[model samples]
Target chain A: MLQIKDLKATIEGKEILKGISLEVKEGEIHAIMGPNGSGKSTLAAVLAGREFAKITHGSVKYMGKDLLEMSPEERSKEGIFLGFQYPIEIPGVSMVNFMKTAINEHRKHRGEDPISASDFLKIMREKKALVEIDSALTSRSVNEGFSGGEKKRNEIFQMAMLEPKLSILDETDSGLDIDALRVVANGVNKLKRDDSATIVITHYQRLLDYIVPDVVHVLFDGKIVKTAGKELAIELEEKGYDWIKKEVDSE
Target chain B: MENDQDKIISDATSGEYKYGFYTDIEIETIPKGLSEDVVRLISSKKNEPEWMLEYRLKAFRKWQKMKMPEWAHLKIPEINYQDIIFYAAPKQKPHLESLDEVDPELIETFNKLGIPLNEQKIFTGVAVDAVMDSVSVKTTFKETLADRGIIFCSFSEAVQEHPDLIKKYMGKVVPSTDNYFAALNSAVFSDGSFCYIPKGVRCPMELSTYFRINAANTGQFERTLIIADEESYVSYLEGCTAPQRDENQLHAAIVEIIAEKRAEVKYSTVQNWYPGDKNGVGGIYNFVTKRGICKGEYSKISWTQVETGSAITWKYPSCILKGDNSVGEFYSVAVTNNYQQADTGSKMIHIGKNTKSTIISKGISAGKSQNSYRGLVKVHKNASHARNFSQCDSLLLGDRCGAHTFPYIEVNNQTGIVEHEATTSKIGEDQIFYCNQRGISTENAIGLIVNGYAKEVFNKLPMEFAVEAQKLLEISLEGSVG
Candidate 1:
C-alpha cells in the first residue's frame, strides 16, 4: 500500500535523511526502530507533507499515487494520519468542532454528504469509549491544558474517529504510562483492518509488545540496514542498537 | 507560503466595498457651510420650538469658540467646517399610517443592506428605526411599543410630541459643551433614535436603529438619547453603513443614556461606515461622544460595540456610576483594515459606594491599518469598596499593521480595587500549519483562530449582532494572513 525509494531530505541546507527506502503491504504493521537523530521523526513529517522539510531527491507512492504532490490538508483528506509526538495546542477551538471540521472536509473530498449531527455524536461516543477519553476533555478547547497522557490518548481517539487508511504513530508511547500505552495500543489494534496498514516509529520495544508488528526494520543513519520478524524487536531490546550500528559500520 | 501571503493581500485589497451603491432620488440639502444661519435653518426645517432653536444657537456658538483637540494619537488634516453640507434629507412624503407609504427605493436600499423593513419579513422581535441621511424615514412596530408606554421614535418626532422628556434629558448625560465633536453634533444634529422605558416597565423587544448615509457631500450628525426610568430595563442597538465616496465625509454623533434608581440599560452598536479605499482616499471620519449616567441607587449601565469601519474613528463610550451599589460594563471589539484608523475605548467613573465595573476590549489590525485602545478607570474617595477589572487584548495579522493600548487607572479610595491586564499577539505560522495538518485550509484556520481570540468580547453582543460581528471580523481580515 505504500512505497518509498531512495528518499533523501534536507532542512535549511543540512541533509537529515540520506538515501532511505521501505515498502509496506495492506493488513501489515511495520515497526521502524531508530536511535536519536536517526531521522525517524523527519520521515514521518515528510510523509505528512510538512513544508519545511525539503525532499531533495526521492518519491513516495501511496496506493500507486504520488503522495508528495498533495498539500498537508489534502494528504489528511486522503486518509494518511500522523499522530504527532507533541500534539499542537489549539486554544479556543473545541475538540468536537475541530473533529467535525476535519471529518466534513474529508467527506467533501470523497464527494459524500456530511455526517449528520446525531451520527457524528454517536461516532464521537464510540471513539471516546475506544480510547477512554473524557467527554469533558473533548468538549473543551483542542488539547489545551491537557495532560501528556491525555494528549496521546486524544491523538488515538482522533485516529479512531477519522479511520484513516494509513496510520503513522511517531513516539506515541513516549511520556505515556503502561496503562495509557496499553489503552492507545488497544485502540489502534481494534481500528486496524485488512485494507489498511500501520507504521510504528519508536526507539524502544515496549509498545511493540502490545501492538505486535508483522515486520521489524532497523533504520540507522537514515537507511534501513536490517529486516526481520517481530522477534527482532526483542533482540534489539536485549542487545540494544549498538549491535546494528556495529554491523552497519563493519559493512 | 509566499504565494499564499500574496494571494491574501490581493484578496484584501481588491474586493470592492459591498455597501457602496448609491440610490437615485430627489434629495433636499441646505447650502454647504456651517453658520448660525445654517443651525437656525436646520431648526426651522424641523419646525422646532423657540427654545430648541435657541439651544442649537448656543451650541453653535460654543462650537465656534472651541478649537479641535489634538491630544489623540491620530494624524488628522485640518477640517474645514465651512466645506461640508450641514443638512440633507429626502423630500418630505405625505404622512402615512402603514409601511406601504414608505418609498420603494428606500425599502430597496434597506433590502440590499440585508435589513428587510417589511414587517412580514422580520422574524426576530426587533423594532427598527430606519434613519437615512438626516432624517428618520420609518420606525416599525411603533403602536405595539406604544401600548407598553414605551416611547420609541425618531428624535425629531420626540421633540414635537414629548417635548418635556426631550427638554429634561437632552443634555443631562453629555452636555453640548462636553467635547469638540459633541458640541458640533449638538449644533446641527439632524435626526436619530430616542427611546424611553417608563418606570417599572420592561421593553418587550429589542430596540434597534439602522443609520445610513445616502446623500453625497452631506455629513450625518445623529443624536441618540435613551432613558431607563426607575426599575426599568431596556436593550438598545445601533448599526450604520455608508456608500463609498472619493471625498471624505464627517460623521459626528452623540449618544446620551440615563438610568434611574434600580434601572438597567444595555446599549450595543455595530458601526460599519465606509472605511475608504486601500490608498486611504475617501471614508468617514467618525467622531462620536457617548456616555451614560446611573443617577439613582442600584442602577446599572453597559455598552457593547463592534466597530469594523470608518476611515478615522475616535470614540470613548463612558459611564458614571453615581448611585450606591451601581454597576457598569464595557465590552468592545474593534477591527481596522486597509488604511483605517481607530482609537476607541471606555471610561468608568465611580462615585458611589460598592460600585463595580468591568471592561473588555479586543482590537484586530490588518493590512496598513492602526488600532488603539485607550481607557480610564477612576474611583473617587467616596467610592468605598469600589472594584474594577479591565482587560485589553490586540491581535495583529500583517507585519505592516499596528496595535496600541493606553490604560489609565486612578484609585483615590484606599478600599477600592482596580486591576488591568493587556496582551498583544500575532497570528503565527505554526498555528496555521497545525490547523492545515488537521484538514483545514489556511484561510479557514485564520478565521477560526481570529474568532477564537475575539470570542470574549463577541459573547457580549446580542445574538443576531454577534453573528454579524463575527462575519464582519472575517471580512475585515480577509487576505491579511497566509
Candidate 2:
C-alpha cells in the first residue's frame, strides 16, 4: 500500500532520515522502533508531507503516486493520516466544529454533499463510544488543556473519523497509562480494514504488547539497521538501545 | 512546504473588496467646503425648526474651535476639511408617500446590495431604513411600527414630526461638544434612523438602517438616535457601505441611545465601507462616536459591532451605566487587511452602585494593516460594588501586520471590582498544518480558526448579523496567513 525509496530528509542543514527505504503491503501492521533522535519521527513527518522536513533526495510513493508532490491537505484527502507525536492545542476551536469541517472537506473532495448535522452527531457519538472518549472532552476546544492520554485518544478518534487508507501513528503510546494505551490500541485494532495499513512509531515495547505488529524495523543513526519479527521489540526492550548503537557503530 | 504556506498566506491577504461598485445615478451635491452658511443651508434644506438651526450653528462653531485630537495610536494625515463636500443627496421626488413613488434606480441600488426595500419581500423580519448619501430613500414598516406607539422613521422626519422627542433625546448621551468628530457630525449630519419605543412597549421587529456613500468627494455625516422608554425593549442594527474611489471620503457619524427604567436596548453595527485598494490608495476615514446611557434604575444597554472596512477607523462605542443595577455590554470584532488601520474598542463608565459591564474585543490584522484595541473602564466614587470584566484578543495573519492593546482602568470606589485579560497570537504554521492534515485547505483552516477565535463576540450579535459578520470576516482576510 505504501513504498519509500531511499527517503533522504533533512531539517535546516542536517540530514535526519538518511536514505531509508521500506515497503508495506495491504492489511499489514508495521512497527518502526528507535531510540531518541534516530529519525523515526522524521520518517513519519516526511510521509505526512510536513513542510519543515526538506526532501534533500529520494522519493516516496503512496498508492502508486508521488507522495512528496502532494500537499499535506491533499495527502490527507487522498487517505494519508499522521497522528502527531504531540497534538497541537488550538484554543477556542471546539473539537466538534473541527471534526465537522474536516469531515466536510473529505466529503467535498469525494464529490459528496456535506454530512447533515444530525448524521454528524450520530457518527461523532459512535466514534466517541468506540474510542471511549467522554462527551465532555469532545465538546471543548480542540486539545486545549487536554491531558497527555486524552490527547492520544483524541488522535485515535480523529483517525476513526477520517478513515484514512494509511495512518502513521507517531508515538501514540507516549505519555499514556496502561488503560489509556489499551483504549488507543483497541481503537486502532477495531478500525483496521483489509485494504488499510498502519505504521506505529514508538520508543518503547510496552505499546507493542497491545497492538501487535507483523514486522518490526529498528531505526538507528538515520537508517534502518534491523528488520525482524515482533520479538525484536521485546529483544530491544530487554537489551536496551545501547546494544543496537554499539552494533550499528561497529558495522 | 514553507513556501506553500507563505504563498497561501499572501493570497489570502490580498482579498478584494466586493462592495466597491459606484452607482451611476444623478446626485445633487453642495459645493465642497465647510462654514456656518453651509451648516445653515443643510438645516434649511432639511427644513428644520429655529431651535434645530441654532443647535447646528452652535455645533459648527464648536467644531471650528476644536482641533482634531491626536491621542490615538494612528498615523492620521492632516485632513483638509474644506476640500470635502459637506452634503450629497440622490436627486428624487421631494416627497414620497409609498415605495412606488421612490426612484427605480435607487431601489435597484439597494436591491443589488442584498437589501430588498420592498416590505412584502423582506422575509428576514427586519424593518429597513435605506439611506443613500444625504437623505433617506425609504423606511419600511413605519405604519406597523406606528400602530404600536413605536416611532421609527428618518432623523429628518422625526425632527419634523416629533420635534419634542428629538429635542429631548438628541445629543443627550453623546453631546456635540463630546469630541472633534462628534461636533463635526452634529453640525453637518445628514439622514439616519430615529427610533423611539414608548413606555412598556417592545419593538416587534428588528430596526435596521443601511447607509451608502454613492457620491464622490462627499462626507457622509449621519446621526442615529434611539430611545427606549421605561419598561420597553428594542434591538437596532446599522450597516454602511461606500463606492470605491481614488480620493479618501470621510464618514463622521454619531449614535446615541437612552434606556429608561427597566428598559433594554441592543445596538449592533456591521460597518463595511470601502477599505480602499490593496495599495491603500483610497477608502473612507470613519470617525464615529456612539454611546448609550442607562438613565433609570435597572436599565440595560449592549453594543455589538463588526467593523471590517474603511482605510482608517477610529471608533469607540461606549455605555454610561448611570442607573442603579443597570447592565452594559460591548462586544466587537474588528478586522483590517491590506493597509487598513482600525483603532476601535469601547468605554464603560459606571456611575451607579451595583452596575456591571462586560467588554470583549477581537482584532484580526492581515497584510500591512494595523489594529489596536483601546478601551476604558471607569468607576465613579459613588459607584460602590461596580463590577467590570474585559477581554481583548488580537490575531495576526502575516508578519507585516500589527496588533496593539491599550486598556485604562480607573476606580475611585474601593469596592469596585475590575478584571481585564488580553492575549495576542499569530496564526501559527502548526495550527494551519493541523487543520490541513485533517483535509481542510489553508484558506478554510484560517477561516475556521479566526471564526472560532471571534466566536465570543459573534455570539452577542443578533442571529442574521452574526452570520453576516462571519462571512465578512472571511472576505476581509480571505487569502492570508502568517
Candidate 3:
C-alpha cells in the first residue's frame, strides 16, 4: 500500500510533477500513459529518492513510512524497484556479483541471513530462464557492451531476482523489440503475486497489451490530466495526445 | 563555472598526511642537516669499503653543487636540507630468523596497512623485507631465495659482502650524477633491498618490501637495486605507507634495475602513502628516480605501479633499450584524491634496432585532485625499425577533479613507428543513475566504473597485487566517488 498527496517535484527549480495525488493497493497494475516531457519518469525518480530533483511539497508514504526520508539504497530495500530507461555500463563488475551484492544488501536490511553462493547461482539460473536471458551476459561486467534489447531484458531479469513488493517500470518498453518486449512482459507478469504491485510507465499502449493495467492515467505538464480504464490507453493511441489536451483545456 | 572554481580551489589546498604514526622505539638518526660528514657517517655506520665511502662523498658534493630542478609540472615548496634529518633506523637490532624477530611496532604498521607480515609470511609463504623509516630491519624466506642462487640482502650488506657486484653495476643505468633527487638519495640514503638473480635461475617466489616512515622531521631516502643476469628472471613488489603528519615529509628514492641477455625483470609498486585531508595542509612530497637498463640482447624490463598517496609525486620510471630485439613495458595507475597532486610518467629510449616498448597509464582524479601523465618516446638515429605505443586515459569522478595528459615524441630514425593516444572522461550522474535503477548502490557503481577504467593497468600487476590494488583504489576514492 502507498499514498502520494499533492506530489510536486522540480529539477533545476522548474516544476515537472505538479500537484499529483494517487493511491495504490496491493496486487494492482497501474499503467501511466503520457507523451514526451509528461513527468512520468520524474514521478518514478521522486519515488525512488533521487537527490538531484527537489520535492518542493509532497508527502510520499510507503507501507505507512515516509519514503522521502530514506536514501536511494534504503528505498530499494523497502521494495521500490525502478527499472532504468538506459542501463549503466559497469566495466569490471560482473553482473552476477553485482546482483548478488544487491540481493544480500536488501536481505541484510530486512534482517535476514545472507544467501549462500549455491542458492544465489540457483536463483540466478531460475530467474534468468524466466526472462530468457543468455547466461553469457551474466559473466561480463554489468551492462557493459550490452545491446539495447538485452539491457531492457536484463532490467527485468534483475526485477525477478530482487522480488520487490512494488516495481516501477519507467519506459522499460522503449527500446525493446517485440520479442524482447514479450520476454520482459512475461517476466514481470510471472513475478506477480497477491502481495505485490506493478506501476508500468509508458508512452504507448503496446506495453499495456502485454501487461494489462487496472487503471490508466494521462500525464501532461507534470500533472495527471485524465483517468480511465485500459481503453483510455487505446483511445490515446488512436486519437493522439492533442485530443486529450484539448479536452483538458475545455475543462 | 562554479564546478571549475571548486576544483581549482580544492587543488590549491594540497594533500593529506594519512601515514603519520609514532611508536616508542630507539632510533639512530643523524643530525638535522646534509653534508659530506653526514654521508661519511652513514657509510661508516655500515662499515662500507673505502670505494663505497668515496662514492657517497662524491655524490654528496655533487648534490651540494646542484640545485633542485623546478622544471617539473608540480607545485612544491623549496626543501631545506638543514631542516631534514636524512637518516633514521630502527634500533631493534636487525636480525632475521623469522617474522617473530620483527619489531612489534612494525608488525602493527603492516597490519594497519592491511598487509600483515606475519600472516602473509606464514600463509602465502613469501619473504617480506620490512623497511621502516629508512632502513631494512628484517628479511623473511631468506634460505629459500638463497637456495635458488638469488642474492637478497640489504644495500648496506651488499656493499660489504658483495662489493664486486655493487661496484660493477652501481649507478650504471642511473648514475649518482643522474639528477637532483637521485644525488640526494645517494648521499644520506640509509638502507633498502638489494636483489641479484643469477644466470639461468628463476626466483622461487615473490620478493616483497613494505616501506614505512615512522619518524617525524625525517626524510626517507631509500635505495633499491635489482639485477637479473643472463637467462634469469625476477618479479619484485614494493609497497609503502607512512604515519599521518601535517608537515610534508620528503621521500627521495633511487631504484636501478638491470636485465641481461635473455633475462626478464618484473617490478611492481603500490605506493599508498598517507594522502592529506580535504583541506590538504600536509602529506608526503615523493621525488623518486626509478630506471632500468636492458643491456644484453632480447632482455626485458617491466614496471607496474599503483600510486594512491602523497601530496605531490614527481617520478619517471624509465628504460634504456640497448640490446637489439629488447622489450620494455610500463603499466601505471596513479590515483589522487582530496587535494593530492601527482605528476608522473615514463620514458622509453630506443637505441638498439628493432627494439619495442609499450606504455599504458590510467589516472583517476577525485575530490579536486590534479593528476597528469607525462611521457616521452625517443628513438636514436641507429634504431632502425624500432617501435613504441603509448596510451593514457583518465576518469574524473567529480566536477571538481582535474586530469591532464602531456606526451613527448622524438624520432631521429626514419624507419621507426610510434603511436600515441589519450582521452579524458567524467563519471556523470546519468551513469550513476543507470546503475542505481538496477539496484546497484552509488558506491558500488563508482567502484565498478573506476575498476573498469583501470583494468588495462590492473592486468599488468601480479594477480595478488592486482587484487590489493583494486581494493585500495575502491577504498581510496571512498567519499569522493559516492
State which candidate has the highest lDDT.
2
Q: Give me the TM-scores of chain B across the candidates.
A: 0.98, 0.99, 0.94
Say which docking band candidate 1 falls in: medium
Candidate 1 lDDT at B221 equals 98
The lowest-lDDT stretch of 10 consecutive residues in candidate 3 chain A is A84-93
lDDT of 2 by residue, B354-435 (tens): 9999999999998889999999999999999999999999998878889999999999999999999999998888999889
Clashes of each: 1, 6, 11
* Candidate 1, B183-262: lDDT as tens digits: 99999999999999999999989999999999999899999999999999999999999999998999999999999999
Of models 1 and 2, which has the larger DockQ?
2
Model 3 ranges with Cα > 4 A deviation: B1-19, B94-121
lDDT of 1 at B73: 68
> TM-score winner among the candidates?
2
Positional deviation of B442 in candidate 1, in angstroms? 1.5
- DockQ score for candidate 3: 0.42
TM for every model, in the order presented, reads: 0.96, 0.99, 0.94
